[model samples]
Target: MSATRSALPRQALVFLAFGLVQLALDTAIYVGLTAAGLPVATGNVAGRIAGACLGFWLNGRYTFAEGGKTRLQRRHLLRFILAWCALTVMSTYLLASIVTGTSLQISWFAKPLVEAVMAAIGFVVWRQWVYR
Candidate 1:
């Protein structure tokens, strides 16, 4: 039991490393698109999709290394997609609403923050359901 419990932090660290890499890639893509004059919402959505693909690959091979090619992997990815879709809609709407409704003027930063929250949530769901 002690050995099993000790592995959790190591696994979490692996997950965090992969997640940060994924976030960096996604942020680069989003920023590039926005700099090229793409609208924030469009660019954000595109970045999220790209990130999800990379994340799925990383999580499947590394984060949940023990469960690759198993039924749990499939279920995890599917549920992740579902959860992401829901969060994406909520985050996008909330960010957009905040941008439009307030004088905060930090539109450039809001999407990344939202994505980070969504990613964290996704990690939890994936760890619990898919990688358990």
Candidate 2:
């Protein structure tokens, strides 16, 4: 338990580091999809797909790589997808709701905010369950 506790901060930093890359990929995909005439929700799906594919490898090899010294596996990949899919749905709902209901200008800002919130949630779930 003490060992796990000690590792948490480092894990979080690694997670954040990779998450920033994934976030940029997702955001770029979202913007491109939207520019191509897709709905925001559809764009969200595309972005999530792109990010999750990239994230699985990065998180597996780097972020959660210490767990059991485990290398990437099919089972881990499956769990990663399931975990990210859940996060994506949640963040998308938050983003969509905020952009639709709020009177704030620059709705694009909502994506980053929603992504940050989802990353926090993802770190807990990924650390405790998916990667554990």
Candidate 3:
């Protein structure tokens, strides 16, 4: 029990570290696409796709690698895509809603917050099921 408790924090820290990189990648692509006059949904999808690809490998290779042991398999990739798709849909809807309600500038500020919330949920899913 203690081991599991200890592992959670360490795993969370590593996950957060990798998540920052993913967030940055996602945001940059999102901003670039939106600035180019793409729709919010399109930009969000592009960004999430870019980030998700990198995130799967990083988390699988390090954060959730079962003490640096498990190599990523096809199963992990498939599971990751499923999870990513769901999360991306939610993210796109939220961003689109925000944009519809307010301005693109507001949506820009809201992007990180949206992704942060999504990341929190994603961490649990990845730890408990996706990577497991």
- Candidate whose TM-score is highest: 3
- By lDDT, the better pick of 1 and 2 is 2
The per-residue C-alpha lDDT of model 3 at residue 123 equals 94
> 2 or 3, which is superior by TM-score?
3
lDDT of 2: 0.79
Predicted structure 3: lDDT: 0.90
RMSD (Cα, Å) for all candidates, in order, is 3.1, 2.3, 1.2
lDDT of 2 by residue, 103-132 (tens): 223446667778888888888887887776
Candidate 3 clashing pairs, residues 3+ apart or interchain: none
How well is each residue in 1-132 modelled by candidate 1, as lDDT tens digits? 775366578768887888788777777776778678886677667877888788777777776665234323566777778877886787667656766876234655666677777767776777766555
Clashing pairs in 1: none
Which candidate's lDDT is highest? 3
User: Which whole-number lDDT from 0 to 100 does residue 22 have in model 3?
Assistant: 96
TM-score of each: 0.76, 0.86, 0.95
**In model 1, which runs have C-alpha deviations exceeding 4 angstroms?**
2-5, 67-73, 101-105
Ordered list by lDDT, greatest first: 3, 2, 1
